[model samples]
Target: MPLPWDSQHFEISVGQIISPALTNSELENILSYAKEQGYHLIYWATCPDRMIPLPLLQSFSGSLVDRKVTYQRKLSTEFTFGEIKNPSHSFEVIEFPRSQANQQLKTLALIAGAHSRFHDDPCISKEKFAGMYHIWINRSTLHEIADVVFIVKNSANMEDCLGMVTGSVKNGIGKVGLMGVQKKVQGQGIGSLLMKTLHEWLISNGIHTSEVVTQKNNIRACKFYERFGYKLESLQHYYHFWVQL
Candidate 1:
């Protein structure tokens, strides 16, 4: 006598999870839809001799939206820290909210300060300096930290600006900009104090790294950072390129 057909062997095909109530054909369609729609799918190789679907948790960080919208810096830094020899000259560390649009003008002027120092060099003449500063204070500020401006001052106004550091905040990373003390004030302990404050702040806040960049020609700034303890992270030959895409 001929045996009746066994329905348990049938497969479903509608991209839906199968249950004991679902015929085998319906489960086949479900898997087909899942694959076509880019949904992840996995099942255990053995679970009491039966396969069980597993959950999938894919990362969104490397997706197109995340990758296309992010920017990374190519420069390295030499870290520094003060040994704290009595805290003789006291300084105040202040944090400002960069939320106010008007504050952006101050930010631009600060960038101008750095650019002005290099204006005479042919490699970064006045126009080039200004353009570079503009790009830094504008687009790049959105990447790292949220524009924290720290300054040291004393008798004789900001002329004794001692030192300054600025950068944007992102995901709690510290990417500092060395608006290094101008040509006049070189070894007045300003750089050390600034780095010390930065170190303390970064450590307290659980920031992972404090990175700053200085031109290879600027031996003074490079040495200054080295005295603090920042190691040479990397050597990169960077060129700025623009495209209207």
Candidate 2:
């Protein structure tokens, strides 16, 4: 599919291959079509069981950028919110107005996408990559992309946001759009508090399941979700193919 948002933002024509698997001949045809349409880059994602061969991909300049993992948790009847244990610092989780925390949230969004696929791809410039996250947070604050946003603040100094998480519910399932804890205060249980707050909000809205996706290389994120009872749902390999035209 044509990625108008990404293309317009990065000033390059971009598209994505929607098929899970493609033969060498099929890929050639797709690339031809992309070039004809003025596409400079194309993204393709494939499951492990249906991946295109490495040799064939290399022939077209397809570079692997990320191994995406999706984790899920069912909010079962036995599920309960555990108290956030923070011996080092006290925190206050609040559902602040989206407009109130736009700047702080945009900073956290940069941290969240620091090691993302866009950042890893050499085809994307640093400024453009940062701009991508900025646009994301801006849309999120407008409630166009995220339904609700939660931030954790130091109780003693409510002006400082230590962590933040954005969530949305659809079809009775909750999805975490972006989440991050400030670097200096990462291990202080602030992330856990933000997550707990999001879960409570989801459950109150009748959402019984939640899912999050992260890069496989982000071990800390994977472990964090696992600690919260989120199980592995699926894994996919992401590749960025830059046309030589």
| RMSD vs true structure, all candidates | 19.6, 1.9
Question: Following a full C-alpha superposition, what root-mean-square deviation does model 2 have from the true structure?
Answer: 1.9
The segments of candidate 1 whose C-alpha lies over 4 angstroms from its true place after superposition are: 1-80, 83-91, 96-125, 134-147, 155-162, 239-245
Q: Using lDDT as the measure, which candidate wins? A: 2
Q: Candidate 2: give the clashing pairs.
A: none
Candidate 1 structure quality by residue, lDDT tens digits, 165-219: 5654456666665354434444656666666666666666666666765544456
lDDT per residue for candidate 2 within 22-52, as digits (tens), equals 8778987897778777788999888866566
Candidate 2 TM-score over all chains jointly: 0.93
Worst 10 residues of 1 by lDDT: 61-70
**CA displacement after TM-score superposition, residue 151 of candidate 2 (Å):** 0.4
Using all chains and alpha carbons, the TM-scores for the candidates as numbered come to 0.46, 0.93
Report the lDDT of model 2 for residue 195. 82
